[model samples]
Target: MINSSAFQGKKAAYFTLGCKLNFSETSTIGRLLGEMGVVTAAKGEPADICIINTCSVTDMADHKCRQAIHRMVRENKGAFVVVTGCYAQLEPETISRMEGVDLVLGANEKARLIQYLSEAWTDKTDEENGLHRHFSVATKDIKDFAPSCSRGNRTRYFLKVQDGCNYFCTYCTIPYARGFSRNPTIDSLVRQAEQAVAEGGKEIVLTGVNIGDFGVSTGETFVELVKELDKVGGVKRYRISSIEPNLLTDELIDYCASSRAFMPHFHIPLQSGSDAVLKLMHRRYDTALFAHKIRLIKEKMPDAFIGVDVMVGTRGELPEYFEETYRFLESLDVAHLHVFPYSERPGTAALKIPYIVSDREKKLRSKRLLSLSEEKTEAFYARHIGTTAEVLLEKAARGKAMHGFTRNYIRVELPSSQADEALDNQIVTVRLGDFNSDRSALKITL
Candidate 1:
């Protein structure tokens, strides 16, 4: 209901944090505003409106969101500022009171932000509703799927095929913030991907909070979705963002190995290798099942890249438990680890659990896991040296070189002189050479 004239000559800038899902949603919002006649604020330029999409995965994410909001207000004086996404959904009142924040929308209300901007924005007064506005429909009301895709990048697009999570893990607030798991029909998603390819996207990453649990409402499966997506004509590649260990079936792994466009890369969350910690965290799978999943992927696609999400210093994770996780990871063939140190959230089940991990211990464990990740990544890269792989080169130039990722997800960087503008967004077979120490990017020979 916003007057179209209001956005006719205005510019808006967006800042996204957290997952690819957030990026996709932000892009969708930008596209919607563009249709309403608002242009994007160019890089390093100020805009009349600034939208900040936030994440609240941890306490640190909340701190970062506050810092970003404050910085945006200071830099873009008098601009109408909007904050939305997970953090806003969890703490809408707090975000609303922040100086210069014009609107605070939650997960359910965010998609309808344009309408609110039209109706509530101009009517609000300092005496009536204080400085900022807030709206958060209950999480239960956020049932419908909001399809979003990132199209700004020509080489790759992150298509949000699914949203929300049903699994209420002990230490996680994603389920509370995002609501239950849901996704669109396969026909709808296929059409979305086709449109993305028609717009010049070469690859799409299927993203969600819990994609492996796809199709609770539609009676479809993640495997079935991928099979249909594989038949899509224009797109050359698709990558599964991440899947739960218990849900990553052997059938899916086998299919990816022989599929036409699916990449041989898997990011499975194995929050802890210790059985005790896994139980305490309410994870669906144990270390045995996780290891079996890894074995299957490696057996089918030996050169496949596997990433692990591991958390350190969760409640009840004693010294013995920490050692167990570290040793198990060391024994596995995981390419890298996304190591997170646990931080207690207010309403999570972890709050009820005894044996809180000291901050000092958490930092030490996080550091140890990160160091282990470096070793695993280096070894994974070393194993692929002297092999040839198909790489989808990205558009951006980092320093004097351009970077790309192989089908197995090994990052490769080539000199800009060697990679012409025509090479951008094109798939090229390149010989993987030695790892470059200076750049930390794998060298590729044309």
Candidate 2:
């Protein structure tokens, strides 16, 4: 088989389906193909090949995947479509059967794509014809690790130190989709982290489905990873994207409180405040534990930004239970909320359980929680008013001002500047001003 190097002038298009991790992976895929001299092209024009990095956090993801494939076929009939990632890993047969799918590489087999596709392309002329290839594992525990994706445009980078999950919660398909937990060695992780910092990233966000589970592989733990990243060069701040309250330790919290690099921000998932509902969801932690974790953070860093991940609709969660959840959150000092109206996925215990929350009810509950989030967030931000906070100025957002984040993760928009200092990871002291009408962020003055 000829190397993809033979297709020096050929084009490839990357379509990423999900979170920041997926985006990072897609960018890396493009980068590798670019190094092989196969460059990515803008959409609409027919590319010789296409890579669709898929996701399957929900059933809607499958629908979107199919929709994207159909659109690709319509746009460029002869383009080769290589499907990989979570959805591809779980339902290789389903994706393989899709029209125009030439290659289907599962989560574990994705890295083999360059080799497989290169061989296929060299021997074939019809790029749109689906290839006879599928790679999937029945048991996640024994699956191999395959890393894709790379860092991004910000002074901040997302290093996927871990992959897959061992927690087979009743409502989750992630363990089946992503396979067992596997991560890079501490030395490898530090190499990538340092590389990101060297590449001009001023901050790095530790990203994963379960970052708290990061260092269970090595003798080192997630807490130790934080300490190591603190010592790395050029990185000013480190943020955890989302962590389980149960896995979040006091030692880690204390480290963040004292560390110069770790940011004072915590995003903990609290599926339910009702013990009965929490039990049904199979979450490891209860309201008491979650609340205690929050208390610990606030006790250590009063100005910390606390974000809660709440699922509005789930089985066994009665209206009273929702009120319990709301009241529990209200009792805390959380600054924001990420509300997900529980969407049922097939093959999950939650789907079979009776009395699922109606879409309307889910919407209502989501709205109610969001309102509380507004009040809590505004109150938290209001506490910092009339004082100056050190902010990392990001590239401008919208029209008029430069945008960045405060130490506590409060996004602030400052008056735009071309002093060359306000670009990228420039740290500047900005005075707090009035709230932006959006209520999503703050407008500040430099």
Candidate 3:
């Protein structure tokens, strides 16, 4: 048996790379350690433990994770390093062999972090077990569902309603890394949200690998989950993270349009606009269905902000197909476009495709979509200028201007003179002004 007192006064530095889901999970881990008397290390302070959560979304993401692991190890010398997340689950052997890594936990094993840390601490000085590189990974049939609701250094909380994915898209490795689709019961999630409200959380973002497939584990539906959450008092705002186009039902969209706290912002993934490319990628929906969803959201809520995820230069994306994608995106009335240049993930069906987009062509296509995104975003923000909207102010450093987001997800910034710390986390009414000098956010007048 390990004594809990052994963890007293220890400081841990957390490094998370990848999606919001990773951040939420890391925060939960921090809280678990906090219960054992471990506190987060301050900036520029050397930590006794370093927890690194990694991502494997793309090749570039993997590279960044490696760099983060190395930097954390160097900055916090002699810290007991622990790595977990999608990358650690997929590449345990590689990460375990890293110079400073002491323990590598997989997706399922991360829950037993404190137990493993205790064992490591007891056995660190054994010369026979020199440089202990222990790894606990469960890659096949990942069935565990770890519930997480954390507000890590932010005003809005990230509530992970679901985890894992069942969809096996040709260019994706999420299903392999995160296991199958799973979620907690609606009652459990509602309780979690209520707890967040009690803790002064005004906003929450529902995050998951495949949130729309939330009913697989529990017999409940995603709409049911949303309805229950809306009934939670004191939750001023709720935003659904990226969901598949096919799984976004009309009932859900209409309900959000009239719901109490659900925001008028939707993030839908339209990987490709070309039907041929969609088939090649094994996507569930085509451009027609995607366009219909966008239209329905606008018809129900004209002021709704629709953000799309578009991937360029996937396998078999011929020149004409690329043009088709460009034209289809050009026709959409979306508020923003998240453009990504496809990276070839290993062991996927996309590798077997005959045609491949060159790096130069991929860069070109990505540039075109990004430019279109900027144009659409500018137009979306301009339409709201001179209009009145409620903004939820977030905490800012002393003497720094405060920033927040509107109901439709428009970023608004206050003047530096109004950077009062008292206004942090307060929702206030403001008039949207013209774009700031950088055009990144609109200047607001209270």
Candidate 4:
């Protein structure tokens, strides 16, 4: 266990769940905690506090959250355990009742966690993990959801210009866990983007629970944010992480296609290809419409990288449904796939349904889709052989040189130029080469 006095200087441990957005927010929070002179302790040893950034996408997420707290207590019996994130935002009371959880912070309260802890911290009651004022957004107003994002790697930062969602899809818990769609003014967002660039961020991913809704100004929309972000200097690329098919507007697609800073990459979620399954899942877009969007993106930029999110094993998905999804993806010109098996979430309409996919069946379906993803990815990589692509050199590799991603999203490792820290953010053109002759990151010719 971490010696109690070791934390007199302030030591912390962090864990996160859910999407890239969660990771981004956790990093932001960790950075804020660092400003107060707290250093992160390795897990298992003891620490001043164990701050858990959680998720509520599924019941499994909540189970893991609860399990983690118990495990933390087992390892460091008297450590202060704090819980926050979407799960806390939805069920602070639930967390408050847990044996090991001392502080349960919701969406808003989590932002000032360190300040709160500093005010109430006491070595005398580490085991008396009490609950905090629940700022859980479960029943709160929608537009009230606060905006936050993450600086995953120094080169790529996720700038959350918006938060919350308006859609009440039957199988989704986001509206309840998060709230309604809320966004920041373009001017405010532009200022933040400028600061991120000035802080050495080479790329900014415009993220949000719902980014398509970014706009507070009259008739303002995400396009305006993209157009303005494209106009910003310093960053070599700006990638739109993901968007709903209906929201990936002609205007937005065209902007990305033409913008010098925007890369030709798009990831759209198509939960299922069968209309029957989609209807049951409450997805707004259908297979036909989803396919059309893919076609349009390919027409504009043949080499543009396209990724699709497919969820298998939903309630209404029959054996035929899996075939339908596979055929749909096979027909697309996408470069890769992110396959997820549908999991039940408490309070979500999905859990009340009678038709359920077995875990074994779900695993089989997931594996089938993932195998196809590898083939599609390999096919995409094969086309790039011998073609020169632009790569942003990040930090070191397994042992030797630096590594980075091409504008199209291919991972490549290049020999170290160790050129000043300037090489950290500057985009370098490299010819695509084969994997290390032995076995390692795919090599590139500078």
Candidate 5:
């Protein structure tokens, strides 16, 4: 057993690799550790304990997680390693068996990490064994919603109001990793938002596995949650991370268009634009319905930023089907695209389907969609070249320039002469200028 004093005054370093929701959870964990007298390790400082929050979205993601774990063990030798999150829940035994992992925490157990650590640190038998082998994972149908908010970054907070997913897309494992849809009461989320504001946050991005499925247990809708969050004072802006196409209602679009707090930005996932591929993937909305949703958002708020998620080379996606998807996306008025090459996951229904696209074809298709994304992004930026919008400045600076994002999600870079470090979290009006040479960002006319 580690003598209780062995942990005294030791720093802990947290490494998180995944979505916005994971970041929110990690920040919350950091706060909890702070309250326990365990401070976060400063940059380049090795700590006595290291916690890794992992992701398992794709095969590459899994490989990255494994590589991080092995690298951490090699660099921070003898440091107590704790692994948690979706990957841990999926493969607890495998993680615990790794060279230096002292503890492994699953989904429900992750939030209570402090308590687990307290218990393990005091238990002599756990230390004698050199590993904590046995662990409990919350059932696959978790109902409890643990709200999280990121801090330390004053410009934006990723507020996780919802958790889990009910839509089990054939190619996805999130339903098994995250569990059924659930959320806390609206009152709880509003309080969390208020707390974020109290901590000096200027913007809050609502995130979840399936946020549109929120309020299933509380009889509250996503729209209702948005309305309540808007009532909270001090937070100048809020953005929804991503929502399924079918779940993004017309009312939400209209409300955001006229909202005083909600930003004019929407990230909607249209995984595949080909109706045939979408049907095979078990997506609820078809191409027609997805198109109509985009049309409505554009019609109501023409200048609103609309970002889409597109996955290429899924199982059975023929060349013609890919072309169909390409044509569909090209016809849409989206501002940006997140292109992904589909990776088959173990135990997913996608593995059973025949006609799996080859790696060469997957890479080729991904390249095409990425090029299309660039063109669409340039067109979107060009549409607002001369317009003025409020930009929330960020801290990063390149030599004498600072960067920020407009309300509609256009990134702008300007000379530090016009933006001082003191204006990091403040929103300022700046006329949009020409796109950068690469078309990735815009120049601000201050």
Candidate 6:
């Protein structure tokens, strides 16, 4: 039990590094703490407690997480530092040894953060070095499902529909850090979505490590879950964060095309477009199946905005393989490409492969893919010019321009002179105008 009085008026700082899933979890944690009478520390104000949620997808991600931990510690001075998420779950000792880190929680222990904080504050001199570490003994033991629906500092909510991944891809460490696939019942998720609607969330993004692998534990299907969410009242829009190609069924695509709230947007991970590289990465689907999924979506919804995840320069990705991937991607009708250079993760099967792409080669490949992405994105936006679309406006800083996203996920901005915070979170019909000055978003006219 926590002494609520002791935490009253206490200020806490939160820092999240990594995916939307991490942000959702961190927001949930903040909400939990808020219930105990703790408030978020304002900028430049030293907090009494600091929580950091980290990611460990790649070597660069890990490096950034470490840097974040150190900077938080320095900024907060004597704040009781707490670290959790994938990186802490994978390497607790490393984070625990960092100065001023008072507690380290893991995947299994995150849900019990309040309880742990209670214990820590109650017994001031409980452990040597003043560090308390609690994590699952192994990845398999991380089975508890922590449901989260939060909209931290944003108009749109992020609902965590599923957690953990069963697919242990060759170049990934997610399965090791997050454990096996698991999810709550569909009814529970629907209730959470309703709760989000009650909290003024008009849009929701379903987030997960392996969303399509949603029913491994519940025996329900992802399509079934989607159907249930579509019926939830007050949610004007919903987007599937990312789904694997093999699990993105035709039935799901068809439902989104005709559903009441589902958006005409999809983010599919096609890590490598080359069949050989896919095989080497132990991906379940081939290039042919991936192309079929893309075609299916386009057939059902012609104006859909499709985004792809492509990794350049992984193990066994010879020059020929890279070219194959580039050519394959060029043939696809995706609107954008999220290109990342492969970083070797420890304790993965990728180490067994001998071929390695040099740093310079990786940069070149990444640059080429990025250029292709820009060309495709510009074309996609150009096609929508002068067209009418409904955009969900977001709150903007005072005296600044307001921005929002269309049903198809196109970002559109309103001029600063005409925009005001009064129109925040309202869906308005606007004519898409020319590209903004930066080309990052399309300007709009009422």
- lDDT by residue for model 2 (209-307), tens: 687898666766898888887888678888888889989999999999999789999889887778888888888988889989999999999899999
What's the number of clashes in each of the models?
Answer: 0, 3, 0, 5, 0, 0
Off by over 4 Å in 2: 43-45, 123-128, 396-400, 416-422
Worst 10 residues of 3 by lDDT: 127-136
Q: Candidate 1 has which clashing residue pairs, if any?
A: none
Q: Write the per-residue lDDT of candidate 4 for residues 107-171, one digit (tens) a residue.
A: 66765666556555664364444434344444464344444555844568888777777777767
lDDT of 4 at 157: 86
| Off by more than 4 A, model 5 | 1-8, 122-134, 138-141, 152-154, 397-400, 417-419
> lDDT winner among the candidates?
6
The superposed Cα distance between candidate 1 and the true structure at residue 282, in angstroms, equals 0.5
Rank the models by TM-score, top first: 6, 3, 1, 5, 2, 4
Error of 4 at 170 (Å): 1.9
What TM-score number comes out for model 3? 0.98
Expressed as tens digits, the lDDT of each residue in 1-446 for candidate 1 is 47877778788888888988898899888888888899988887788788899999999999999999998888877677899999999999999999888889898888787887766545544334234888887778878667787765446888888889989999999988898898888899999999988888889999999999889869999999999999997889999999998889888988999999999999999999999999999999899999999988998999899999999989999999999999999999889899999988879999888988899999999999999999989988988899898999877653467889998889999876786777889999999999886736689989
* lDDT for 355 (candidate 3): 97
Superposed Cα deviation of residue 215, candidate 1 (Å): 0.4
Q: Kindly indicate the candidate among 3 and 5 with the higher TM-score.
A: 3
Q: Candidate 3 overall Cα lDDT vs. reference?
A: 0.91
Tens digit per residue, CA lDDT, model 3, 1-446: 65679889999999999899999999988998899899999999999899999999899999999999899889987788899988888898889888788888777777677788887775655633225465544546577787899998999899999998878999998887888888999999999999999999999999999999999988999999999999999899999988999999999999999999999999999999999999999999999999999999999999999999999999899999989998999999899999999998998889999998999999999999999999999999999999999999999988887999999999999988987888889999999999998999999988
Per-residue error (Å), model 5, residue 170: 0.5
Q: TM-score winner among the candidates? A: 6
Q: Can you give the lDDT of residue 104 in candidate 6?
A: 87
Q: Cα miss at 317, model 1 (Å)?
A: 0.2
**Winner of 3 and 6 under lDDT:** 6
